[model samples]
Target: MNLHKILIFSSCLFLLPYLNIVLFIEETTSNFYEKYMSMLLVCNFIFSVLFWHNPISKSIIHKIDGFFAKLSVVTVFLYVAFIKDVDPYNENIFFLLYLFFISFARLSNKHSRKEWCSNSHIFYHFLMHLSGIFGGIVAFL
Candidate 1:
């Protein structure tokens, strides 16, 4: 990934845990799962930043980042769907939309690289951040 994209992606990852903590401070204190979930989110943010900045091959970095990103998403989905007793309909729909946006961003990124389209990659990077924001909103609501 480009350095700019990497920086923006890592920054977004860093914000996710903070956003959750701020938005659900009360629930985080009262709910055991939420507490642990917050910890996981923090760890995810830390490790993502570390891995992205580590001295590794770009391909390896991308693989590791992608794995952790997907894992974090799955963990959040499980927490929201099974652990919390919140309304499923809205949350599930939002989560699905988040997934859709992420998938499209990934696709766009791949196509941009293959076609040597820098603008497309930047657009997809923006979409990726937008998806993360939507996911944060879903968590809060």
Candidate 2:
């Protein structure tokens, strides 16, 4: 199938994780603040994916969603490093973030303003979500 169809189909896949998060995550974390923030970050990601078809809204959505996205990663790192008193490096946070960096950089390239982007762009955004989910599962669970 085409990348556009693949991207939309992938968004539906995220819903499973989203439901899992909402249903089971509240009592898992020690900190309520962090738990809610992480949930919001995931929802933002799902919304960004759902709304990505709109060219005019793409940049705006990323601007809003991306802030929370980057913030969530950094916050997760900080929670691991200071609050949990563990070295984030031990968990390979940088390695996880590399995918995010590459994905964001590629998606934000000059071609991003167009109604559509290369297949790589769609794939990278999808990877971004996967990395986020994997990183969260590793760090939190």
Candidate 3:
């Protein structure tokens, strides 16, 4: 597909591990998800500022990313401001890597460096999910 589609599609792929983590964390406790949701907000804030003037990024993904990023920040604020306790490690770190992977993957595509990083991104993406299986075991046990 074209660049924009690739970015969005890649983003969707990048989101799978995150979604799984959300589900897995949900099973454990809402506080865990809230903590991670906070981290994602910080990540998104950095992403938006860094990519703000980037002409290469897809507008759709950029906008959606901004929305989610802001949502994450607000969610975390609300969680912390109201929630009694927040545990950082409840959600797997691999999920954070999942966000990094997707963002880098999209950025690489925007820069037309896909030939260099696409395969590696895909490889890491696959490995991250596989690691999630292991993480699930460790997390629940």
Strongest candidate by TM-score: 1
Q: Give model 2's TM-score versus the native structure.
A: 0.61
Judging by lDDT, tell me the better candidate of 2 and 3: 2
lDDT of 3: 0.44
How would you encode candidate 1's per-residue C-alpha lDDT over 21-95 as one tens digit per residue?
767577535466555556656655665566545524356666766676667677667777666666878687767
Q: List the residue pairs that clash in candidate 3.
A: none
lDDT of each: 0.61, 0.58, 0.44
Using alpha carbons, what is the TM-score of model 1?
Answer: 0.63
lDDT (tens digit, per residue) of candidate 2 on 15-49: 44345556666664546645665576566556656
Which tens-of-lDDT digit does each residue in 32-127 have in candidate 3?
754475356345534543443342445764666667654653453354335534246544353454455456545544544555324454445334
Order of the predicted models by lDDT, top scorer first: 1, 2, 3
| Cα TM-score per model | 0.63, 0.61, 0.31
Task: Tell me how candidate 2 scores on lDDT.
Answer: 0.58
C-alpha RMSD for every candidate = 4.0, 4.1, 9.1
Most lDDT-accurate candidate: 1
